[model samples]
Target: MSNVSYYTAEGLKKLKEELNQLRDVERPLASQAIAEARDKGDLSENAEYDAAKEAQGLLELKIAKLEETLANARLIDESQLDTSKVLVLSTVKLRNKQNGMEMKYTLVAESEADLKSGKISVTSPIGKGLLGKKVGDTASISVPNGTLKFEILEITRN
Candidate 1:
C-alpha cells in the first residue's frame, strides 16, 4: 500500500522539481559513470567498476523511492484548513511550560520539515502531541531526555 502525504503547492512543486532533477540529470550521470567504469578493465577484477555499479544501484533505488513518493503526494489547499486547533499546516504559537519561552512552528509534511525555518513534520513528537489541541491546551511531549510541556498560545492558517 502506498502512503499518501499532503503538501502545500510550494512543497508539491518542489517535490516534482526534485523528481525531475533525479530522472533527467542524476540518472544520466549515473549511467555515464557506469559506462566509463565498465570501459576501464576486466569486470571481475575492477574495483572502480564494482563501485560504480553499486553507486548506480543506489541511485536507481533513490529514484524509485522518489517516484513512489511523488505518485502518492497530494496538494493541500491552505485556504480550507481550520484555525481552531493545532493541525497539519497550522502555524502554532507555543509557550514552553517549564522555561516560559515562546516559539512558533508550522506543522508540515515529513519532506518539508525544517527546524531552522520553524516548519516541523506532523509525525514529530511535539507536532503529534499538539495535534487537535486548542488554544491554552498544554501538550506533554516526550523527547530523548524527558517529557516537555508546551502550551498552545494560538493557531492560525499561514
Candidate 2:
C-alpha cells in the first residue's frame, strides 16, 4: 500500500533534490567502495569486502525507499488553505493559558517540521489539538508531561 504524504512545493522540491543526491553521488560512492574492497582479497576471507557489500545493500534499500516516498508525495497549495481555522500550513499565534506567554508556530508536513523555526508537524500532539480551532478558541492538548492549554489568538496563511 502506498502512503501518501502532503508537502508544500518547497518541501517536495527538497525531497527530490535529496533523492537525486543519493542516487547520483552516494550510489556511485557505494559502488566504488565495493569494487576497491573486492580487489583487496578473496571474497570469502575478506572482511572489508563483506562490510562494503553490506553497506552497498543498505544504500540500495535507502534509494528504493526514497523512490517510493517520491512516488507517493503530493503538493499542497497554500493559497487555497483556509485561514479562519488552524490547519496544515496555517501560521498560528497562540497564548499559553497558564503563563500567558505568546508564541507562534506554523503547521507543516512532518518532514518540514523544525521547532527552532516554529514549524510543527500536523500529526504532532499540539498540532492535532490545534486543528480546526478558530481564533478565540482554547485548545487543551494532552502531552506526555501533562495537559496544556493554549488560546488561539490568530491564524494566517503565511
lDDT of 2 by residue, 1-158 (tens): 89888899999999999999999999999899989998897889999889988998998898899899889988988888888899899999999999999999999989999999999999999999999999999999998889999999999987
Error of 1 at 156 (Å): 0.7
Q: Give the 10-residue window scoring lowest on summed lDDT in candidate 1.
A: 78-87
Residue lDDT tens for model 1, 1-158: 99999898899899889889988998898888889988988889989888888988998898899889989998888888878988789999999999999999999999999999999999999889999999989999999999999999999997
Whole-model Cα lDDT of every candidate shown, in order = 0.92, 0.93
Top candidate, metric lDDT: 2
Model 1 misplaced stretches (Cα beyond 4 Å): none
> What residue runs in model 2 are displaced by over 4 Å at the alpha carbon?
none
TM-score, per-candidate, Cα-based = 0.94, 0.95
Model 2 residue pairs with clashes: none
Cand. 2 TM to true fold: 0.95
